[model samples]
Target: MVFALGNCALSGQIPIWLQNCRKLQVLDLSWNHLNGSIPPWIGQMDNLFYLDFSNNSLTGEIPKSLTELKSLISGSSSSSNHTTALGIPLYVKRNQSANGLQYNQASSFPPSIYLSNNRINGTICPEIGQLKQLHVLDLSRNVITGSIPSSISDMGNLEVLDLSSNNLYGSIPASFNKLTFLSKFSVANNHLQGAIPTGGQFLSFPGSSFEGNPGLCGTIDSPCRAINNMGIQPAISSGSNSKFGRSSIFGITISVGVAIAVLVAIVMLKMSRRGVGDVVEDLDEETGRPHRLSEALGYSKLVLFQNSECKDLTVAELLKSTGNFNQANIIGCGGFGLVYKANLPNGVKAAVKRLSGDCGQMEREFQAEVEALSRAQHRNLVSLQGYCQHGNDRLLIYLYMENGSLDYWLHERVDGGSLLRWDTRLKIAQGAGHGLAYLHKEPNIIHRDIKTSNILLDEKFEAHLADFGLSRLLHPYDTHVTTDLVGTLGYIPPEYSQTLTATFKGDVYSFGVVLLELLTGRRPVEVCKGKNCRDLVSWVFQMKYEKREEEIFDSLIWNKNYEKQLLDVLGVACKCLDQDPRRRPSIDQVVLWLDGVGTEGTKE
Candidate 1:
């Protein structure tokens, strides 16, 4: 049996009558206004393996009796029997619907306990680690105090464990490295101290998992100081009155100072030889003019991929080709920086993105973009040719698209509306969908910003998704991740304002806005005086509701002969723009629907 009433806005404490349903296997009451403490009787439910009471006003300490859950302590064999006998249809909803699961299949759901985002307090009971079959345990964003229970390492089957944004102190259990199956772990924004455990699954976790805990160290960026097993730094006594000790310390300090001065002098000599202190204006014999060489590119290598056509490319040649990234060579502007067109010495062309902003912020964007582009390789995705880190400047090289971005064609060019025929527009949508589908596959990647400006067009007008500076990696088990709200204004999903979370569904919403731009030949946000100003999404919905769907098409490409095809695509776009993210279809589904439209059009 299962009962899920999440996001229902229900008030008051959890009903006591729930104890009467002894056979219940799943109970979800999250995202509600329910108050008061969790009932102790809840631990008496022997068959319960999935319990979620997150995002509530619940208070009081967690009942220690929770460790006695029979199904979670042993296995789901008993719950499987009940599910087989009742054949209940259970639906799990975590921001999105799970499309009802049959009783037999429902037993396959991972055992979990969620009590995050609450006011619950009290140290975690060490005895609660008896749930050996539990797969997920989350108790984040609460006032829970005290150290993490070291006994939790015994839960061998655990996959995810989150304890962020709590007052928990003390060192993490070194034995946690024994959890071989653990895939995700976090204790961020807590009072935790001591060196983080190493080896096993801990090696797979990112540094973000241990953030906000300054007392903790041992990460690549934050190395731990020399300390004993008890985590205390050793200090020398200053009360010594011996003359021999004073002389020894003074001699060692002088030797260390002399060594540092010698090392600085040696480094300075090397820098001078590498052209850091002098600017050499070497003239190109063929051009009869001096070649431009940026001082920032001193001794910096221009790393290029094996597939790059520009062989023997150097940082000096790259600077000379773009005239040191002059304004005249700038081809476009992106959220991060300007895009300069580089005419390589080898007769090949490439686009160089010179990232702007503070060094720290630009460094993050540079790394994010490089990491994303390196992993995602599809026919419809832009290719990253190379990159360079020259002093404070960061540069990314890419294959220059001859036709430029879709935004320039759709909105900037006067004849763009007439040039992009209905068939070409349909093809662009299909290609973009396929590219997005690939990114949403195994080891999913979310393009936080999706708009026409980020979609480039090749010589053949094929769409290639670009600008991954705001992209993020999302594992299969993760539903969503909280991040700073970043995206183009008109393309941002409505739910982002409240949730501040990015998901695959959010990308679909932004793509829907792009589709509207294609069909209407209008910008996402129309600028006008008085009451005439309105966004394209609102305008499209108003027209559809008023039985004026035919009027929403771009007049330049609209043809009565292709009305059926246009309306079919319009329906697909409408589904993508569903107000509730759960109702929106996945990118894979969108690809199939689009292919169906194209197939039908061909047959006719």
Candidate 2:
């Protein structure tokens, strides 16, 4: 059974006999007035995946035994995975069904544990890292004390982590960079101090997420003071021991003699040419290519997504599957990195993009792509299956797109004579709009780059936005100004060139350019007279002014039957391409207008 007696209003300590129900997967006892400490035996059930004890009068420290659940680490709810010497299975369940709350159920959700709004106290156990497969962990509104554990960083598959309204203290851990899949993170109303972790998911979270913690510093509002030492140390006495007097003079004399001998030996060694050559060789060895991981070991980590078939996945197996990233398996290459097609042992096909660079800037770029893809999930956005890191190598795994990118269909006639139908074109535009709208709505996110080449299509020709290496998450303080200007040439707006600020309106302008590409089927910048060229937006605007709007439509899509609907979409695209950013419509408005056009066609 998945769920036991939930919302039953039962009073008294949780019955220890529930441990005997070994097959229970979800146990939600939230929203009750039950009192007493959570039993450690609850962790003994191996097949459990969901457990909720929120909104109760439960007390005492969270059990370290809860982390022993093997299903939370291996993505499998079976007793055969983690068995104690006594042959008992370790089990755990993540339950959040308190108060009958309805949540947006995406295609998949990872193993989770929610124990919020209780009287629980004591520090979060470092042993929680044992649940490597956990995705959502909420321990909010509790009286828990002590510093946040650094071991929490080891859970590579964690996505939503909320520890708000607690008494957590100390600096956020630097090791949190390993949590590439983290999307929603919070620690508000806590006693956390020192600089906040600045990379990975930390960058995407708005200042609101870290609001109530005044001691915490970094991009968030409050700054930590310069204290000599936070932890208390034992007081030292001024009095000297009688035993120290016996060897003090003798030890000082011997130490002086040994120091002089060592100085003389160093002078002789420095005079030798062979010794200097050896020193230079050692320096070069340390500064050269990354030697952090052994080549024999292949990789250091392999993290799979929630419903991945590669349960027993390993870095060694991935390397062997790609034939060491040989050119023969190369399927695509772009500004981010090279893509290789890999067939895993469970018959799951994936596309792996190998980001190759040792520089800090490149590392940030790789992290941005992973974090953005993990956070923004829409039907029109490509899914990130997982990621791998070893030495200087960084690889991102995504579901393979069979139909390739939108650029291929527009420029290269991959399909011989059959042009994309008008309805299909409208559907692709609507799907892309949904994705862009979602990104624009995110607090700090701005997709700096949006072009045809970055949009991939599936087997059904459903559009999925791809390529987020250039995406930027502005700090909450910066309302509309950012100095770093990064985007494709033709898609960038005129206001961006002068002000160097990225805004939601700027993204709308780029999407307008994409819509124009779909309608006219022409490149952004087309060559005209020698050394001169006309941008697609300029040409379309000029044609509209000259009363020649019909001349610029794609010869294949141009027909009296589809003219009315095409014209309606063209008018919306033109409004998006308005020279003034303020005049351009919001992406949400664009979607409504486009939806109306589709509705009108259905009525006809």
Candidate 3:
């Protein structure tokens, strides 16, 4: 079972223990960059024969020990293994059909040698004459400038002899006449000279097989043997051969230059526009304006930021994945950016949000906002992959959520898909609480525009807090001032309409509205008082206190045996809706209550 996997172009050094395959019959690693001296252990492969490693990056002399396989190396094996060193050992016992051929994963065998097309430049080891079972002997395409070893002629099993495209010169041994079984023989494109044998299978090949030599008379039509320059060998030294050494060095130099140029460009751009507070951390090269997972909470090992794991994702990669911000790929849109569905080059589906250019000169503020948002992490919050800043364009990358925003599935008709489950609703609330809790306590960042539109949903029905552009990260040292009000009309806190103040309590109020929507299966702030509606939250609250809770509960929640659980959820939401900001429970407290409820539900 000899394999002829030459010129594979597969990079990387071969892993060491391939010889451990005891069943290996043939191996062909020729015409590749498989360098390093031929290991002597190859002689241990007793079932090998047809060796053809003529032209490759292999270095050092041929292993003299290869002469040992006198009785074992055969020329033929399965054709499939003919192109690879790996072979699947067939199991006749597993064969249920008439013919035994079947494919399975656990089966394996190895092919024989073909380590050519390398820098193997030494003379052909005379010991190769001992391979009686050898079928294919191609030692062409090398720097070995010597006569063809006379011993090769003794191999009765040799069918293919190609010693062409090398620096070999001098008379072809008359002993080659003894190779009666040769089928494919070639010595073309070499410096070999002298009279050629015109009989046997040699007659079939024309003078072209004997080209490149000014000497060497042959019986073929060209009569190259008629030339008198005979028995001359070319220089065979392989000196200072670095392969890609020159280009690789050049590429490294260019990469460094480009990186420096980018640094200079960023500096020039920053110096031109001052007054954005001295964020000295950005200039530190050791840190490189790193992207921190703000919500990272002791999860999987892969979640932790490791210097070895990932490189800073480029803007081009993000753009390509998100279809260069195509309108057709838009999955969700927000005040600051439009989220688009995209497929990464690595075949990973992702959600990429391309923000509109900050026309009023808010790009830096927007970028800082997104950076702060991207670093924040929570189980209920969407995972931000990385962000891209390509000139005036900005994009935020997030883990692709199969299920879209909560607004779509909750408010609009699902077209007959499964409704949100009570238990799932509770989980969503808890995860959302965790995110809000982080925003409230960890950094005190207030999501100014929290609502059903911003609570994204994944396929698992988990909730993620998104759209942080309107979000304002609290200063650790100074207070932030807001003189103008901003937020959706429906979910905006009652006081926010009259006062321009923003706080975590305002977000909690909005969240309360959302919780009520989940339970009532109604839009938040719908005025259902009279025929209109008392804004879903107000109506639900009035119904709950009046002991007519079921009137507002969606049938999905009312009919289920989980009324007690839904009531607990309702109570938590009610706490969030307290009029006084001081009266409302902090998001962390809300999270704790949901966790307690989750624990209780687990018992059922």
Identify the candidate with maximal TM-score: 1
Q: Write the per-residue lDDT of candidate 3 for residues 103-168, one digit (tens) a residue.
A: 221112111234435566667777677665555565666666677888888775566677777788
Better of 2 and 3 by TM-score: 2
Worst 10 residues of 2 by lDDT: 278-287
Global CA lDDT of candidate 1, please?
A: 0.77
Error of 1 at 175 (Å): 46
lDDT of each: 0.77, 0.70, 0.60
lDDT of 2 by residue, 1-604 (tens): 4444556778999988788888665577876788889899888877665678887899998987888875575555433321112122222222442123221111112367888988999889898988876777999999999988899999876777899999888867878866765756889999876677766657666676677876567752343434466632112212474234536746966998899899968953643322232121111112223342235333254556564455565666666667767656776666546788888777777788888632444577777887787667777887877777654677787888887777667754424114677777888888888888887776466787888878888999899988788777766766565734456656888887568788888888999999998898766753211111236888888889889989878776888988888888899889889999999998888887888884563121
Worst 10 residues of 1 by lDDT: 276-285
Question: What's the CA RMSD for each of the models?
Answer: 18.7, 26.9, 28.3
Q: Rank by lDDT, descending?
A: 1, 2, 3
Which scores better on lDDT, 2 or 3?
Answer: 2
Two-way TM-score contest, 1 vs 3, winner: 1
**Each model's TM-score, in the order given?**
0.53, 0.50, 0.48
lDDT of 1 by residue, 1-604 (tens): 6777877899999999999998787788988989999888998998888898998899999888888887778663333343222244344444332222222233335679999998999989998789887888999989999999888999977878999999999988999987766766999999887789987667657788999987788786566666555554213223575334877868967998899899968964663343222222212112223333333433353556666666667767777778777766777876457888999998888899988754545767887887788778899999888776555577898889998888877766556668999998988898888888898885499998889988999999999999999889997799888875567757889898668799999999998888888898776754211123237888889899999988999997788887888887888888889999999988888888888884564221
